[model samples]
Target: MTGLRVSVGDVVDFGAASGDRNPLHLDREFALRSAYGRPVAHGALATIVALGLAADREELARVVELSVDFDQPVLPGLTYRVRRSPRGVEVRLGELRVLTARWTLADRAADTAPAAPAARGAGADRPGPPPLPDGGGPRVLGLAELAGLVDESYAYRVDSAALAELLSRGAAAGVPDALTGPLAWASFHTGMRTPGRDGLLVGIRLRLTGARERPAEVWSCRAEPPLVHRRTGMVTVHAELDGAASATLTLVSLLRRQVAAPTLVETLGTLPRSNALAGRTVAVIGGGRGLGAALSCSLAGQGARVLAVSSTPATALTREASAERLPIEPLTCDARDPEALTTAFSGVALDGLVLAAAPRILSLPVAAATVPECVDHVADAARLVLAPLAAAHELLAERAFVVFVSSSAVLEPPAAWPHYAAAKAAIEGLAGHLARHRPGLRVVVARPPRMWTEMTNGPAGAAGATPVGVVAGAVVRHLLSGPAASGRPDVLGPDALSGP
Candidate 1:
């Protein structure tokens, strides 16, 4: 416990220094007009003091989540003490609580340890919800709407009055927490619809990213449709402002209780046209790895002539192709080298391109990484994915499907892998731009979560990992779904994909 003596002059000085000139905090006359009879220090002032108290007691990591309620205002010229307990920190005035707060502590060990690998091919064995007779219930949002949901480059803005009000509340209460209320309301109305009147809210989770506290005259907002779980009626909605996540809301509601579980294939309206790529040539860039290997096999099995490119010599791919009697050719190409890539595929025309190769991942946190290291790494990633498009444009057939295999880390960036997240963000931006400008090219970016692969062979990967074959199958199905699937989404994941 720590005690601090605060005077009226101290409160006034704090208000001036913090740019919080709210009359309730600084002006006795103005404060008298309000419900509180005397001058009261800003609620944030109490929170700041409490936070300092909490930091002093322990070796502070990052402050993950902070929620506080100001039940009573603290009058100036009084001594207030901040008490820290296991549950949280609190500010009290001689036994009367002024403000109460709770915060989530970060795990120090997670930053140093490798993530555990999830169960291999976990999604395939798990039974999906039973398929509905007429497909599923009415979708909360349309396929096209959800597909092109997030455009990080788009410009957006919040109203000036709204921004000011939020800032005032945040300055007074220690957070921009009030801002989420409106955002949540807008999101619910725009993206959600209850199937039945008896539906009840079962769960809710909210996360805030410390981006900007003040809104500009105009700002761009990026959002994606809720990743709905068909059986449990769980939905996750994400929103970002100025390229950073501002809020992520996860909700579980008692909605859509049907005997048959909804399958993505049926929800998308039509089944894929079979043998759609019977005569086409498709290239898998990272064909040596698990998911890429599965995709190479799947595409060839579907009658597409497959070209498998990997940094390592694909002896296993050749063996698999020969055993299956499929038209799969293995070729070695350093995706980072434009010369090697162009030389390897100089003459072969392509109808589909799968960009899936990732560099060796370093477990260092973003803060520990050097600027040059990240720049050079991201440079290679961009070159590998984009260079193929320029080199093969002339060789690409009209309406050629271009797919970039991305990761779910772009959505929830891991503390230890910021570089991967940044690079993937750049890739998604590139995919979105290409989709808008290149009408003749079909672009699909697949971001599968926690697939059991060499990349996910550590402690963190051991939970909720989808099977490689399941993801691979979904990718092929999307490709064969005709023009409706083209330029439809910048990225797709298991949430939006169902098994074959």
Candidate 2:
């Protein structure tokens, strides 16, 4: 898309607006001593830049599947550029690192005559910020309105490296100043930093490789007022993805986009601890692995007294709690068997219960009836284990949330693992019934796909698993958000298990 660039000040502002005041963005002192040797940039800024790039194709607001990673941090004085295609957008700094993301166009209502929204990245390229409006009177443009995103020609894939170089030149030309460069907003109030009344955003221009590098299609993105980007003058981008590096970590964050105030911080005059889950006793089943473990960590980190459990106790998972010195009781019990489950959770006057466990599910060629052993692998395991453990959840505390580890596999399965798919489908059905029938116990369900676990990857790895850590975080968020919270089951992919 055309006219897709961002500024550092805007990136900072967006981060501030989002209330993500990480030291990396706010503390120069901390940044100076860190690995980058200077304050590094927030990756979300790249997301906003990606959105800016999409603006050339369509309004990015309608786009989703907007995933990305911070190949390396963006530091001061570095010139950068945003490039896009129907398939995706890239945030790059010359030959250095860049974060990429997918986008799409959707939801534009076209009419009989002409549509209001412009789909192509053709339009008047908004230049650097105008000098303070004369006498504060209605600000007017100095140049005639240039052709804005009008047709498909402007919509071309971009070459990240070339675009970055162009931006460096433009940065030198002073076409866009530092205030208009890559930046994010983290505002305490919506109007804390008003942009010329209507929230006029200053757009930044770096450079682009334009065309040949864009994606096949950017989903659900459309055109609209470009008020989010500001300019940051081009500086030499020193950070790189350490060229020798491979297998970079993907980052998924709710911190990227704007969030409601209450979601960020409690209302003013409200003591922070007033809302803290401090002094609370929460029961967590499956707390020893994957999502359960992640939830346990988040809660325990919050100083909550967490009672974590799993199908089989793992020393690594249990020690996580002890390391934090949080009061956590990791237990080994068959949750479907009421007696053992209840006895394990007996002493706690629980306020919340999070069930985030799935019994032992080993993916064998269970469909090979020729080897009755394969067929019985799942069937034998379920009848004596999973089914009984599920029944045992009846012993949880009132207001408890029994979060069964469901599976997205039920949505689709390949030809090989028919048995595993059927079992998971039945588990989901059971979870649905519990959710619908037992409203009081707060039966919630989480379905994350194959996660990155010692059991799921590498040469010995199975076909469809993700990182254990990432899956855990998704589960933690689900369990923490109460009934009033969105009840949709959390679904994560393999990435969700490993790391972002």
Top of the candidates by lDDT? 1
lDDT of 1 by residue, 164-268 (tens): 233333232222222323232222222123221212233333454443433323334454554655444443445444312254434333332211111222212
Provide the lowest-lDDT 10-residue window in model 1.
258-267
Q: Candidate 1, after superposition: displacement of residue 199 in Å?
A: 49
TM-score of 2: 0.38
Worst 10 residues of 2 by lDDT: 238-247
Q: C-alpha displacement of 375 in model 1, angstroms?
A: 2.5
lDDT of 2 by residue, 432-452 (tens): 666555565555555666544
| Candidate 1 wrongly placed segments (more than 4 Å) | 1-274, 460-462, 485-490, 498-500
**Each prediction's Cα lDDT score?**
0.55, 0.40
Provide the clash count, candidate 1: 18
Name the lDDT value of residue 125 in candidate 1.
Answer: 36
